[model samples]
Target: MPNSLRPSSRAAASSARSASLADVAALAGVSTGTVSRAMSKPEMISEATRVRVMEAADRLGYVVNGAARALAMRRTKTIGAVVPRFGSSSFPAMIQALEATLAEQGYTLLLSAPEGRREKEPDILRAMLERGVDAVALLGTDQPPAVLSMLAAHRTPYVQMWAPPGSGSDAVGFDEHAAGAQVVAHLAALGHKRIGFVGGRSKDSERARHRFEGLALALARHDMALDERAIIETEYGFAEGFTAMQEILGRRTPVTAMVFGTDYLAAGALAALDQGGIAVPQALSVASFNDNDFAAYLHPPLTTVRLPIREIGEAAGRLLLARLGGEHFEPPPMHVELIVRRSTGPA
Candidate 1:
């Protein structure tokens, strides 16, 4: 027989009956209401009574049924957020902002990540929904179709972060395309004609694709074109960026400057360039997106676009709150700016 099915010496006492709130109240010499208040709203009861009720509950092994309480209130008072990844990115800071803002509103945040597998997003989202999350916040508009469909069917209030507003959904983010264009224009103004771009696969990320599109537009405006051989695509990581940079350098196309998808990747590329004895801003001017925490501390400092990650997260939380409150208003697009650091210069 399975261990669970086997009887033990304590089985008779355990199988007698599970403890209930009434049982706890009886032992504490209080009413069931008092016990309930002590567990749910301790401030409403005296400290001594709360302690007695708690002790009775502990003695009886009684546990509060959160699911029952949530059902009665018609809300779990919990918000969920799905991010792409966590470490070595701005997501952690953004999540912190979300948690802080939500806590102020008496709501808790449940965070989930796909662990680098886009296909696993739907399952993660489904799990959140099953847990009775009051609302959800998605990292970007580029969510899996199944996840979107499930969210729509569930009629859950949700907002998209890190993307522009007015996409038939509540969103709190800046225009990635515009930021990309600004970087390219800045490089062009510095007289970098032979430029290269190293980034993740465009198909996997709408933000990356928009940035690339913006770069293309800027290049066209400057009467220049991206060298086909100079474009390198890989996973979004420092090591990947380093390897991509080495590949771009080996192409013999004489790239005078480079643009990366993120500062993390830019840092990796910088390390690779340093190993090759290539001086930044002299041998190759480099720029990228997202002025992350480490962007300024880099050896030469990174010339990148600053995306207001924390602000976007707080705004996303507010948008969800507004949705829950049944308010209909679109937020204006957040602005991004180019930060000219030492990483890029005249080619």
Candidate 2:
């Protein structure tokens, strides 16, 4: 009889009924040592023998203990993702795709949110490291010096997303600046000579800054400029958009059109304009970035720039995985385009 068949073995087997090396060996008519080798270093076993052992293990409800596997391999097949937030449709959809793709390679995705608050980044990274993440994904190109130092100290692979053009950072996203410029160019082509831009406050967002720079470049190209008084920078929110538009309306500049930093902002602008008795595209043209799903259903619809938001997230996942596996990667530059709609007309 096999060693596992001894009287003493009966209790041990019962205690670990979920399955054990001995159980697999017995079921496959092999030695316990052979089963151990098959579980730990499968390549050493013959293909026929390995398949039999694996099938027996499956029948016996055997699962490779990841903790023990990690200890032996010195690798944790988990990636960390740290983003500003994850409330929008784009983030969720991309994350779903990324998770599914990673699952194919037996990897797991660990997500963390700092809400664009720099103060929380270090703590969040520490937590991720504690969980033994193999790599990390960051948002935007302008990573803070402290975060960069943390990643370097651990020698962990990191990636940035939703970056600007010419960022000089390892990233995977479209040029936000160009997206903004497209909005400006569209407004200009619609015969709107005077344009007011509703922008997100740039204190914590390098992406927002790039978007504004692109709009400025577009204005300069048309021999026009944003009225300094009409430019309203507020938090990235609908209320902020509403208030920004109201402030622009308060200005003496005859605002023929208003470009917003995001679709959410545009929606708020629409509400404000409605309440103020100002007609859209007639009294004032409204445009925004990130052709969000909500943009299509707005009262007059939004003419905006379409962001490849889901693709950006999926790319971020692949980039992190490649780096974790010691694969060489040259992160691809992504591009965004303008989606023309009925939000603007001849001014």
Candidate 3:
């Protein structure tokens, strides 16, 4: 056969080539042993040499075969994370706190933001398990059955954040239902009998469902009912809140107050009320959940329920680490506070 008809050795090699420690070592002018040390025991190597090896690996798009390494060493030194989305300030800060805590013990965070795609969690967790992540950290308590099944099948240790009942023993979070009820109680105390709610659709977020249920229960206790037509469930976005507010107003229920599921949603509702020439507290009292970073800085500081998010993140990390280390850890109860700010007042 002619050279063109047969397999070309050069092209075949080019197509089959994948960067390995030997390749990285060659490019960085270091031994393969030194490259291995830089990757697995960077603390034992000089910082300058480690940086050189890392740069070379990056240039060659090299990823250590974590599965193979884990089988040999029995640990990946990684924690896999799954969350709804990182759009708001909360998820990033929460994850950052967890990362900081894990880093102390030489663990790295591998994250997946299913963002509007919560259904992908099972697949993400499966991939992480296959890659040999040592543990997993989940955002909400109400994980899907498939996700729970995959974890159980692999016997992968995991912990839940934003804790409530139904998350099993490894839950670490505050009272989401209590926070929602507290918002309503604050408004009810202010003599607002009629109220509307704007938040993420419950189908998309387990927390959203808990919050609404708590608010509804509180409303019933106060001799007030959540009007089906007045409830506006939308995306957890500013623009979504704006549109939701418009829809609620169009219902003509004439609710005296409005409760939002998140501070971002509350901020958007405030803008819509302003554009419509309605003054907060005087015309419509506004309050929300998650006293997130911007809650206290809104045009009229928002009244919201405060969640100890950083503490939650840190505790979840510590809890996971303890379990991984074969140490006992009991999660302390976290409380939520209702903050009364300028955005809300009397009916």
TM-score of each: 0.81, 0.80, 0.80
Mark the regions of model 1 whose C-alpha exceeds 4 Å error after superposition.
Answer: 1-65
Task: Give the TM-score (vs. native) of candidate 2.
Answer: 0.80
Clashing pairs in 1: none
- Lowest summed lDDT across 10 adjacent residues in model 3 is found at 1-10
Candidate 3 per-residue lDDT, tens place, 1-347, comes to 11112223332343358777777776777788988999889999988888888887776778889778877989989999987767853778889999999998889999988766867888888899887898999988778899989888888889998867556678988777788778878887889888888877888787788888888888888888666777888878788788888888777787888888888888888888888888987888899988888888887899998888888889989999998999989877788898899999888
Over 1-347, each residue of candidate 1 has an lDDT whose tens digit, in order, gives 12122223332344368877777776777789999999878889888888888887777788877688899989888999888867667788888988888887768899987666789888998999999999999877888899889989999999888875456667777777678778888988888887889876788777678778888887888876688888987778899889998888887777788889889889999999999999998888989988988999997999999988888878788788878878875665688899999999888
Residue lDDT tens for model 2, 1-347: 23222223432474456666666677677888887777767789887777777776776777767888788777778877777756532466666766776766667888886566878887888889888888787777767687888889999887777765555545777776678778877887888787788776677777678788888888898877687777888777778788888877777677688888888889998999999998888888888888878888998888989888877777777777777677766656577788777888888
lDDT of model number 3:
0.83
Local distance difference test, each candidate: 0.83, 0.76, 0.83
Predicted structure 1, TM vs. truth: 0.81
Instruction: Compute the lDDT of residue 328 as modeled in candidate 1.
Output: 73
Number of clashes in every candidate structure?
Answer: 0, 0, 1
- Candidate 2: clashing pairs of residues: none
Q: What is residue 122's positional error in candidate 1, in angstroms?
A: 2.3
